[model samples]
Target chain A: MLISNMEIIPGKQIQKHFGLVQGSSVRAKHVGRDIMASLKNIFGGELKGYTELLQESRDEAMDRMQQQAHAIGANAILNVRFSTSSVAQGAAEIYVYGTAVILE
Target chain B: MIELTIFLVLMTLGYLVGQYAEKKHYQSIIEREKRLSGLTTVASRFPPPGKQHDQCLVLGSVVISVDYFKRFIAMLRNLFGGRITSYEALLDRARRESLLRMKEQAAKMGAEYVFNVKYETASISKGRQNTIGSVEVLAYGTALMRPRDEA
Candidate 1:
């Protein structure tokens, strides 16, 4: 399904709106990754392990959102947004939401 | 005495390695920024005036952690309650890097301008006392995809 943050798609037209659809995932850092991260932290740099983890989590969340859109018989999601929060120590929650719509 | 030695060792390690890492990151950011200069990024919720084109959602995220030395310094700074330059630099880098990544994603999707850009930031904690272990930055926007022949 097509996904965008713009309220209106240029080529396509919105035929029907299915309201809001959302997906979320909560992830925590493992001991091994944390060990590696701490070592890298001594040098101050990007934590590749954590980056990869978050990326995966985001993709998963997006996938779930798509699934919701598909279940609702919508062809697209619009005005998509992402939010992150620290739910626990070493853990993060990612939420993605958008309006499901039928595009033609 | 042993504590002093460990602190010295960690401080030197942070100084040497952190400096190298920061330099490398800065160079990388500059290079990417130059490469993506063709794409426009704006914070306004409204799209730029132009021939209506397609639009897509694009996002980029990054996580950065401070060095041990910087954390230690920050802890000390807490006592005096002053701006921590070390953390300031770390956060600045994270923010810019995430934006660059978002631009890269938009460019890949054949979008010329990224509009309605937004940023979300969260701090991951490590200890019970709420010590910030790492910071995550998420940048997202709508990319206005124009016709390929418009150029």
Candidate 2:
């Protein structure tokens, strides 16, 4: 299925709207990675480990949202948005939502 | 006394190294921004009309941690109730770097324009005593690409 953040696809039209479909995942950092991150914190640089971790989580969330759209017989998802929140220490929740629709 | 000495050492190290890294990053960001200026980015909710193009989602994210010295300064600023310039710079760098990375990805995919761009910022770890440990910035957009046959 096609996923986009724009409200309208350039040349296509939406036939049906399935409202909002959302997915979320909560993940905690590995202990080893945390140690490395702390060390990096002293020097104030990018945390590659955390970046990869969050990216993975976000992709997973998007996949789940796509699955939901598929289950509802939608051909595309539009107006997609993402959010991240700290659920607890060392753990974060990646949430994504979009409107599922059938395009013609 | 030993703890105080250790704090001082870490603060000095953070100040010197963090400043150097920030300068280098800014330089690189500026250079890349110039190179990538051709890949236009916009926050409009819809793509321009009359173009039949393939579209896909693209994103870039980064996590940046605060250095010891900067964190200390932020703490002091907290007491005074004014702008935290150190953290401000940190966030500014993170935002620009994230957008650049997103543009780089779109360019790699042969996209000519990015639309509906959005940004999300989250504090990953608050650290002990309520200090921000690290911040994550994510920029996402829909990339409009020429049709395969045309490109």
TM-score versus the correct structure, for each prediction: 0.91, 0.96
Model 1 ranges off by over 4 Å: A11-13, B126-128, B148-151
Regions more than 4 Å wrong, model 2: B147-151
Error of 2 at A9 (Å): 0.8
- Mind giving the per-residue lDDT tens digits that candidate 1 earns over B105-130? 88888887898889888886655456
* Interface RMSD of the candidates, in order: 2.0, 1.1
lDDT score for residue A60 of model 1:
94
Per-residue error at B54 for model 1, in Å?
A: 2.6
lDDT for residue A6 in candidate 2, whole number 0-100: 88
**lDDT top scorer:** 2
Per-candidate DockQ versus the true complex?
0.66, 0.81
Tens digits of per-residue lDDT for model 2 on B14-69?
Answer: 99999998899899999999999999999888788887999999999999988889
Candidate 2 per-residue C-alpha lDDT over A1-104 given as tens digits, one digit per residue, 9 for 90 to 100: 99999899877889999999999999999999999998888889899999999999999999999999999999999999999999888999999999999999
